[model samples]
Target: MARTSRAPRADAARNRDKLLAAAAKVFGERGLDAPLEEVARRAEVSIGTLYNHFPARRDLIDAIFPVRLAALEQVADAALAEADPWKGFVLFVEGLFALQARDRGLNDVLARRYPASPELSGACHRGFVHLVEIIERARGAGLREDFEAQDMAPLMWAMSQVIRETADVAPDAWRRFLAFHLDGLRAGAAGPLPAGPLTEEQARGRPGEPAGSPGR
Candidate 1:
């Protein structure tokens, strides 16, 4: 007879679930770099147990973010369906900013790449392509001929910072900032800027640097 695969032990399964829940909470509050021990502590488990369930930080991130990434893609798809290119572009940007404002973990995910996680990397790549399409459509509609898709990274990075700093004192502060930036992006907003946009590779975040490192 062929050997049968064994199911996870009941306690092991429960521990995994607890770890995931705690990780989502901690990562949401502190970003992906939060200490693993905190997740274990919140899950009411030992650190060793947490390691047993997820051998690496990337493993834990992979488990927690697939749904969130899928949701982001859905938002992109919705924006792409809008008939007006400028409207679509605005909707896409606002949707992305809203997502970052709502979920700290997702904010980090958008701004950074965990190189070991292929799934996350692929999802981010797709999102980048979608952004290019949105930018092209808007340009074709005479909205912002000077705009470049690569400009999105720095913009998102700045917006994330705005959200982080003003979350408590002025939760809607990013709206004011975004409005000013958007006006500058309009077709005839001003004379051409001196510096060129960053390359896509640069916008993707530099290796060994935190996502959206301004120094880059």
Candidate 2:
């Protein structure tokens, strides 16, 4: 009886593993909004089985993305370790965009598409702390004094759009955009602006949200 009971548990574990693998592949290719049904089909399991393992989409996202997003922390660490602050900052920004360009689901995560996942939110928060440090260091070196950590959100959003639009037709198009922007961030290139940068809370909120909207 004990051995028979163990067999079902083993099968369930296998199904769970298959679901995770399928979800990762489907989500990576199609973004986080990819249907759970496709993940189930790719896993060769019933939709019920997928739901059995991950009751909701956020549950699956929580499982798959936190581990992947952990790499962002490592990238930040590498940036911080670099001797040149400006180079370090560039490394962090370029590394971030490159990762997003490679994975559509990750791009959505960076854009805060699913605000309900605790794991993803925590990961993003931790990454933000590192970004603050990187920006401060770069400012001390040669970055524009007016540039704030909050400014990166709009810059990243624009880059995300560029990557999405030109991925097939011009895979390296974002590089040109990034270079132009990086130059503008230089202290020598600084100039008066019509408006100030967003507050951290405003930056975290959806685009066009009122300045007072609660951040996700």
- TM for every model, in the order presented, reads 0.84, 0.91
Measured over all alpha carbons after superposition, the RMSD of each candidate to the real structure, in angstroms, is 4.3, 4.0
What is the clash count of model 1?
0
- Candidate 2 per-residue C-alpha lDDT over 124-207 given as tens digits, one digit per residue, 9 for 90 to 100: 878667998999999958788888989998998888878867877887899999999999999899899889999878897755
Residue-level lDDT tens digits of model 1 in 129-186? 6877888989957467878888888888888878877877887888899989888888
Which residue pairs collide in model 1, if any? none
Q: Candidate 1, 152: how far from true, in Å? A: 0.9
Error of 2 at 196 (Å): 1.4
lDDT of 1: 0.79
TM-score of 1: 0.84
Off by over 4 Å in 1: 1-8, 113-116, 140-142, 207-216
